[model samples]
Target: MPPLNYGTFFANFNLEMIRPFFKERIAFRRKAPRRMPSLAFTTLPSLLLLGSFTFFLAPPARARLTFHPTIYEEKADYLDTQTVAVYHFRNEGDKTVTIRKVRASCGCTVPQLDKRVYLPGETGVLRAFFAFGSRSGKQEKKIRIWTNEKDLKKPYELILRTEIPRAVRFSPIFLHWGRGDTPITRTVNAWVEADSPVKILSIDEPAPDFSVRLQVLKPGRGYLILVTPRDTAKPKMRRIDIQTDFPRKKPLSYSIYCSIR
Candidate 1:
């Protein structure tokens, strides 16, 4: 201060000017620590919102289904005078379903399905009855089922076939004939209602013990045939041939086979 040094004076003045800047920097550094907790709290809410949004956006799981007897009635066969039953079809789908109808390719096969609606994981039954009474050898039949399922577009089919023996079958076909041992005497007794006029042209017997007689109750209207067997006649099989004079149905034949002791 006594020598009045100008360079030293200017340096001292610059140091005083920079000292306020240092103080301000230190104050800002001290305030940074207080801001850390507020910054942390603000970021936590944003992170929680992001996590909730991600969870809700995920896709849902898919439903599943199962079917019982997906392929059924693999094989079915029968013989003459044999009654065949087809195994029932069962469903195990995840959703409810209904069976609309059941049908057969031929009159020989009769099919019946459960008419009630089936619920999820429920089962239904289908029965097929085959009558081989008059059916002869080498026959093939089909049973079709219609259902209300989203997956199935057309009716499902079950196939049945058989190699039948060459034998004659009677119209009064059953386990036990409704009538007793007494033979049918009148043609009217053996007649059945028919849409077209049926006439018996001729009768034949394969075995000596078996015999047949015919009469026309009404011309071009109806007729009756009498089937008789001798007391000592032990016939293994019997057959009868009927000829109709009508051209619509040229000829119709009826036959029967039975075991006599």
Candidate 2:
């Protein structure tokens, strides 16, 4: 070790300091050749693994249960003895579901569910039968189904309506005459039409105190039925049945309500 010039000493010191850096650079270059391409390929697989993990950890979506003919109905005009069929429903979800029960608004309306548990992508049938015996005018009915799914708890609904036409024309469908505890006389006006001439075979009331009289306002034109209650009758609600025969037609029956008060 001899005394050295300032520049020479400085140069040696710098070379010594940079020697390890150069070796590290060379080692890194050799170890990581094609770094960008390798890193890109490695990054894609890592991202895919992360995505798969996330997918496996996620919860599945809930199943949805539904009805076909979401609404079922019977019209008021349907014959009293007629039965209407409510078609089946299709399930569009990916899981199994069940309809626990089927119900109707009234005994006149009956409901039938084919099966309780339904497989994914299957069809289920529900039939509603309505018995309209002696029922007239506008009517409404409903069908409700209970299900396991929360969203479909109140699952089904149906509507029905009815309309009736008269075979003979009359000013009032119902008539109240004479005196009770309340008003003496009250009348309801109604009209009837038929394809052919119709006649009033007979008029009768179950209560002896209530009487009905048919007046031929115009021969073959139409008739008015005057209902009269005896003055001694007490105030009460009553119904009267009217029976008539038409030429070449089935016997007809009509009912009227009277409020004596």
Candidate 3:
């Protein structure tokens, strides 16, 4: 993925609008060399016009909002079910600003604010809750803020970054063994981070040709499961499922593949 250059958007906008104004000013300056005193008198009107144009292009300081930190970062553990991220901003402008709407990029992130409007010199905090249902690893989210700041054409973008450490993971979910050959044993390793603790409920029932044995390295979370061929005399195939105590409404049962030929 490519990094986003947010400044380019506004830079292009300002350049396009100011180009014509500068073009006319340059033409007047070139003609002034031909007539000194008459051009001197004539340039006053152009100078006034230039000043007025500058005033029109000046940034609106009367309707501005200042964010303390535009981006919020969170370092979270893999087992964390939910976490709250907060951002603080102040209405630095002299005029009151009304928040038209606040939107988030992901459904798992929800933004909460007290009201829709903010008085001048008032401060507002945005609380966004990130629900880590079954997600892991580094995640980035976006929040768009729309306000009645007349000068702004688009909503301001705020970034939310969350880093979730992968605490638990399974090696290979699928395994196979050749049939009519020497019955060999296959192994499945369940690794858990030293910080996070979890318990293994059971290895769900396997196929008739495959038998399983579970060994615990750590009392609660770590385990080594051995799978052996019960009868490899003929061709057979089986899909073995394993169960755990992980709390997920979505039935996220782990599985393995076994085949003999």
Candidate 4:
């Protein structure tokens, strides 16, 4: 016998089952006063065969790697000089995948992975270490990842978001005096922005031409620094350091600028 054509067989089978309905429809139309169109009924068999052939020849599904959460958020305390962010993911496709590279947005963030290759249905974790150093306020880091999967045109990006607390927030960190100007005392306001209590340990002595003093406004919650120039006849510049008891290893320090022209 000749080779069997599945598409033709299916089309012929369906047409046999639907032939009774088609005959009834035609008989009813013939008895009616007006004649209905027959183009759709005539072309339906060809369309059905084409659809069946296309469906049988379709391509297989591609592999896909998915993450539980693409974005992560956290709140960092003042004592935490460094923080780690974790991203959990798994291969959900039939093919195995290999992570070619992981790139971080900045040098302050380092990405780490246990291995490069992962089999189908395997799980993995991507960790990023962010060094706060002297950074404060809201911070965000982006990580781009590459894989051996071909279906994906662009690399996947993961976001790391954090809010770092400030030990003390200072306003007007700099004070200046113009030449021949009157020597007046200026005040710098300091507000405790950390969750824990932070006290002003001491204020270092400024240059001989400038004097500095610290006063408590709300105990550990707030304070004020008073700076004055003994004489503004000569130009002078100085940086006054304010010590705090945040942490020994990563102590928090505040500084203010003073200058006379």
Top-scoring candidate (lDDT): 4
Clashes found in each candidate (C-alpha, N, C closer than 3 A): 3, 10, 1, 0
Model 3: per-residue lDDT, tens digit, 117-220?
Answer: 88888999988888887567789998899998988778878888988765556676667766677787888888865353666677765757688888999875
Give the per-residue Cα lDDT of candidate 2 at 230: 61
Q: How close is every model to the real structure, measured as TM-score?
A: 0.37, 0.57, 0.56, 0.63
lDDT by residue for model 1 over 90-157, one digit each (tens)? Answer: 55557766777778888877877556577776655666677776555566777777777756756777
Model 2 regions more than 4 Å off: 1-66, 71-79, 105-107, 151-154, 158-185, 193-197, 218-221, 233-239, 246-249, 257-261
Across residues 5-28, which tens digit of lDDT does each residue of candidate 4 receive?
Answer: 999988778567889999999999
lDDT-superior candidate, 3 or 4: 4
Q: After superposition, how far is residue 150 of candidate 1 from its true place, in Å?
A: 2.9
Query: Which is the leading candidate under TM-score?
Result: 4
RMSD of each: 17.8, 8.0, 23.5, 15.8
Whole-model Cα lDDT of every candidate shown, in order: 0.55, 0.64, 0.78, 0.88
Model 2, 1-261: lDDT tens digits are 987799986766757778999999999888985735687789999999999999999877544755556654444322245567666676777777787877888998888876789887888777777776655555667777777776553465655444443465444554443443543445544344656566666666647656666776555556676666665466656777666665353577667766554
Shift of residue 75 alpha carbon in model 1, Å = 11
lDDT of 4: 0.88
Instruction: Order the candidates by lDDT, highest first.
Output: 4, 3, 2, 1
lDDT, residue 89, candidate 4: 91
